[model samples]
Target chain A: MSFVQNFPFFSIILAMFSGIVSSVLSGKKARNLSLAMIVVTTALSAGTLAFCLKTGESYTYMMGHFPAPWGNEIRAGVLEGVTAVLFGVVMFLSVAGGMTHTAEDVEDSKLNLFYIMIDLMLSSLLALVYTNDLFTAYVFVEINTIAGCGLIMIRQKGRSMSAAIRYMIMSQLGSGLFLIGLSLLYDVTGHLLMSPAKESVELLVDSGSYRLPLLVIMAVVSVGLAIKSGLYPFHYWIPDTYGYATPTGSAVLSGLVSKGYIFLLIKIFYRVIGYENLVGAQMINVLYLFGVAGMVMGSVHAIQETDTRRMIAYSSVAQIGYIYMGIGLGTTAGMVAAVFHIFSHSATKALLFISAVGLYEVSGDRKDFVSLRGAAYRNPLAGIGFAIGALSMVGFPMLSGFISKLLFATSAFDSPSKMLPTLFVLAVSTTLNAIYFLRLVITLYSRRREGDKPLPPNPVKKSSRGLKFAIVCFIGLNLVLGMASQPIVQAITDGLAMFE
Target chain B: MDVSLVEHLLLNIEETVSIVLFGIGFTILLLHRNLIKKIMGMNIMDTATYLFLASKGYITGRAVPIVVDGIQDVSAYINPVPSGLVLTGIVVSVSTTALMLALTIRLYERYHSLDLDEILILAKEEEQI
Candidate 1:
């Protein structure tokens, strides 16, 4: 019944090993090994998920069995359980989609490194989520960030190097500010453990001499995290990076890398500034301001974007806005909604990006709007998957986005401060989201003109059996998950109850 | 506020002045467009972060955070964790800077220019077509 005792963090260990092995293998062997690894890992992840769901135990893994508030601890509680399940799902799907590319696009020299970095990224992210120690979490963050850069730079062509460099530079700035925030926290309270750090800060706040230190630390850390989360005013790097990277790389980065930051943000906010203390509500306003700004700005920019990848990149910025909005509400429902949205957004967006891989492969890599005039007619499955992702993003009924946003809006109405403005902001942003994503959907779905020059024979082979089946699997999962949102919502609500 | 000796040491005039200068250098980094010059500014900023951490460790009579004085009774020395973290951070920053420089060289080879504006123009032109 004890999932942690049963799971033994084996998925993460296996992930790292598989990544290394996959990178080393080549030709038929590499493909077969990767497939086997994906199947085995997915089964292991599912076992972990089932055990957690059944027992509903908040499991804590103490590395070296050290006492917390002094030493490190990794907790596999409800939130961690949900995250693990999401990680498992993403890994399985990405690998399935990646099988298509491996047959043709992969360079034998780079394959080993690619698989290794992917595994390392997943394993480090798993570690980051489990650990409650502030310093340890930052270490994991750095590892994941660096590994992500490695994945992007593996391409070593186009703007990938520049994209990777920019990502690296920005991440360094974020890491520096994050460290400074930690330093400032250490000065105020000579502890690295999050719970005690919160206690010490609370004690100082009551004393009143070091209030500014708390504010400074909050500002620095928030800015640093905002850079990673691609929140407004710090989103300059995301579009270019996502646009330039390989499709698989972009999918994983968007799906998982940013989630690492969001996970840490939730932890820091919960552990260091407990929900009860945050009821004073200035942080809510800040979230609302930036959330709305990112939503509106990102959506508007996406509407004008001619490049499909760049447009999707912009849409991610806006989708993250919805998550931040949920956080701003600061209720149990809001937090739960935020977590649910994270799961749903990652799934749907990864599918959308993977679909683009199919299109790009066939069309010889044209990403601009004009080039995609007859794409929907050529690849109906991809066109349909993009539409579903777009619809979910716009919060259409029965889709995953609807459930999360409805909960978020309900929570926003109950917010203690500036409720009307918050509601207005979310509503306007949703409308804008529909406007842009619908445009993409409509363009892709409409019939091609008869007079249009016959599109050239696709450069790459039409979707192979394996690739087509993978796309179908994702589309099927998206539909089923949409129909089955209630249980997921209930699980999130149960998880958030701990914070309350 | 009940002031400690450590706090008084941290409030030193000369160190504070130099910290201010370091801040100015990093601020200049945000304004400049010359990639090489901006990198130099980043190094300046990196030095400031290191100084800040080291200054926090200073106490009037404390020795360096090492066992040089004696194996036993090391509590009187400056705290070592921040210094250790900073050491790693510095290495990371150096490697990142090196990588960025390499990328800049590649960009120059492609566009035959080092100026950000020129490269951006070329990129935009490509995108337009």
Candidate 2:
């Protein structure tokens, strides 16, 4: 009832409020305001996480004094709190990390618009993470999608325009399906909040009324989110969209944007549908099969890519596969692995994209892997950052990816029937990951052979000191996450235990 | 055995009609070749979805959800939640339509054509160059 209990409420409202203010300002002022807003959000969310840990209680804050059934609400548990902090950190770093790229890539006149869209996107991501009401989630999801399209086409270049169109078409289809699914759900349960919906769904299932329709809705919602998140079979728009966007766009779209939807999916499965019914509906099997296929096929596609950014995009599809595979395992530990992978993938991919921009600048602005022969020699900071990201992606020991992969493998162990196939695909994906990422690492460090294009007469200007500091933080976080896995994993498991 | 199912679904003309509209809109969005046509299809799909949702909240003879004095029975009013949701959906769809048109205009400016295949071919040709 006090001010502190409303941390989740104010955190979301503050971000959304900043987004509105951001739209009216010049680009420079907007960036300053956004930075201040993000820092405040990060601090507040971290406070919320600490408070939740101390109290060991999850509570819901109702909107505008309306009761739960009538008005919207936000649930603040340790899981939601931690995810909000992650969203803040990633958004903050993404803009800070690619500051120069944004300046260079966006038209000077339209820079204000870019910052506005980024702020809106951040607010939407935070809202998506915190909102307890399904309809609120849908509204923010659209806001996120529109802001995403703006980020992609801020260039107004031919390639980015085409990419934006494709991205919008695919995303619109996904949201449309999501809307239909939510309509069916509301019709069935007559409740929009997760707990009441879960109760109604359980009763409906128990009585076996319209069981087939319920099953179909589950599949529809699952596939809808899968498509939007660029999981396999729905990832056709990903490489073009990520590859063509500016570095900051690439980082935010691939890293932070995708995770919000995945977070929603996890919440849906764990809280709204009830995990028992979710597993019983056989949706996980479909997700499992596609995830395995994505693991292999995504890597293969990455290997064939000529451009570095597109390769990273394809690799993202593969990483998403690992996350989905964990979710589809249908165990609490598995869900933790999936969520852990979400964090690791987000941090590592954003770092990779920003570093790739640094590599591009010194390589005569060529994004091709061949042109990056001696990038490290010119800019050791980006080179080292890229190496850290590559190592993590390949699941080297003592990194975040390894822990997520290990959690995934161990989690699958509980289901003996699924153990071998899951382990096999994971093992194969690891090898495939090494093949592409190590090749790039070797290319970065490889000597500038004579026949290759000469290094630019002068090295491109080094990235701003702020960007370097964020990269250092990224490396340190990845290393610390790897070394200190026990507390975090235990925390994740504990947080998930309190879900719903 | 299936009599009740058919009556519940097929006899509900509003639901069936809206669903049919959704299917048609989806087909147009997916299979159409023109950029403007795709936007139209998207609008149609939005309309269909709103119709479906609005129809879901309807009652046979219920009044509007506004409460007048002495109307104490909850059953006297239709559900208002779906209409509220559909209003938000309409706003989102309108914004989407506007963005799509802007994008289409940009594409038309670049390639001088509205056909999606023609634009794709032009893009591929440009890439080769």
Candidate 3:
């Protein structure tokens, strides 16, 4: 095996190890160690991406001495490599950008615990991306959920504490459903490894045996993942969970954590149960229906939201709706668009959260629309960052959101039955997206009223060079995703082609 | 409704029982107003899943999975994978239960109520104040 092939395994193990080591260290040391580990993993994943692109194939690595059927395995392809790299970049930016808030919001004693959770969260995300074993994916899903709950409650407020419990309950319910579904799948297929299971599933489908069981399994697994990712009907916990957490927590949870679950669902659809079978089961129709509902209702909720952070959180519901809509289109091109939307949404949402923090800082840590007026004048970089993120989310030309939107529109033509509803929702959702995001932008830049009382003097004047750097990099990342989307989409197409 | 369906259900009594238990646990989880009861409901749901998995691994007149005295035949043992999965599921459930209980403790300290609705109201009142 080439040395580059070891990168995925090494990165996952390194992240888990660092998480363990950080638990006992001081808070500052843990933070530094976590940052260093993120940088190293990003480089490693970039190397893997380059190697995979050159090889133009997927390779599976055994976790131990045993081979695939009897042992755990992780597979890496163009899709996994690109996703890992994107996750690493987004995570680093989110953590670095929200560093000031982390220091202030979390108490001194439990700070190292925060870094520990972050490290574990990253490890879980990477494992979810590369895992070829269904059981291993379930284990990592639990890790991600627990660590995410810890991140929410680490801020040590009553609101955050309560939100954590609500999050935990919903998440546990999702996992329980997922576990039951997985057990049923294993019972039917007699294999836990994805490839072997896929073979068994194909045989069963061809023989027309176990049809009802197969359909039930697909619905159960899809609903489990949909609930976890906060698709329309089950997203009641999002506003409080995202709105009350620390800035980094909000960014990472909304940007990467939910996307991880969706990626796993995509893998299950393509790799485990074959997309054609899923379509036959009519699960895609259900997803498409919910996706359309979520698109309109999420935006409507956002319009009704009074708080700025909560508004952004509601927008996330809408963005997730768009991704599911793409997936529900049930074509290769549609899946490609869905995957690309994952990337664009991650970049733009993380940027918005981090920049919103900067705005909050200038406005004396209040997130209300009234207090945010003219706050951008004090922090021009943050103001500009917010503008770029908002505009990208609004699907402006030469922005990442626009590219994904275009991909969705073009791909919708492939399916005649889904075409009209897809286009109609696209038009309606885009208008709704514009109304809320642009309103926030205007609120940020609007001048303070002459009759309003003067704001309190700013307290701490610490230099936020790290925050500025992260914002600039995020903006650059968004632009690159928008302008150079062709290659990435091609990469995703190649990756999905190799998926089976 | 049909005789053959009843016969099949009876033959797979363990699976039927487990499914019924799962339904009960899920309903309790959804309907309970107290935080402790909700956690209890979650644990019950987890236990039902473990029961289901364990039933799948067991076979009639089969020995435990371990090899006994140079007997390496596959027929000598029940399927071992489901048992292993059940063990892992138990560990995860324990940890999740512990985490949920800890959060409940904190919430009680803050609101002095074990009822979710009461706590939510108290929290909103605190926010306004």
In terms of TM-score, the best-performing candidate is: 3
Off by over 4 Å in 1: A1-3, A6-14, A17-57, A102-106, A279-281, A362-364, A450-454, A457-460, B1-31, B64-71, B126-129
Best candidate, DockQ: 3
Docking quality category of candidate 2 according to DockQ thresholds? medium
At residue A17, candidate 3 shows an lDDT of 96
The C-alpha RMSD of each candidate to the native structure, in angstroms, is 3.6, 1.7, 1.2
For model 3, what is the error of residue A276's alpha carbon versus the real structure, in angstroms, after optimal superposition? 0.4
Q: How many angstroms is residue A486 displaced in model 3 relative to the true structure, after the best TM-score fit? A: 1.1
Model 2: per-residue lDDT, tens digit, A119-232? 788888888887888989999999999999999999867778888988898888888878888888998899888878888999998998979878977987888789889999
Q: After superposition, how far is residue B118 of candidate 2 from its true place, in Å?
A: 3.7
For candidate 3, lDDT tens digit of each residue in A1-500? 99999999999999999999998999999999999999999899999999999999999999999897989999999999999999999999999998878999999889999999999999999999999999999999999999999999999888888889888888887898888889899989999999999999999999999999899899989988998999998898898899999999999999999999999999999898999999888899999999989999999999999899999999999999999999999998899999999999999999999998888888877788878888788788899999999999889999999999999999999999999999999999999999998988898789989776555687223438788988999999999999999899999999999897
- Per-model TM-score of chain B: 0.76, 0.87, 0.95
Q: Candidate 3 has which clashing residue pairs, if any?
A: none
User: Which lDDT tens digits does candidate 1 get at residues A265-371?
Assistant: 88787778666555553665587678778878889888888888999999899888878777777677778778888888888888888887776655556776555
Cα error of candidate 1 at position A215, Å: 0.9
lDDT string, candidate 1, B79-122, tens digits: 77667767876876676678668767877787777665566567
1 or 3, greater by TM-score = 3
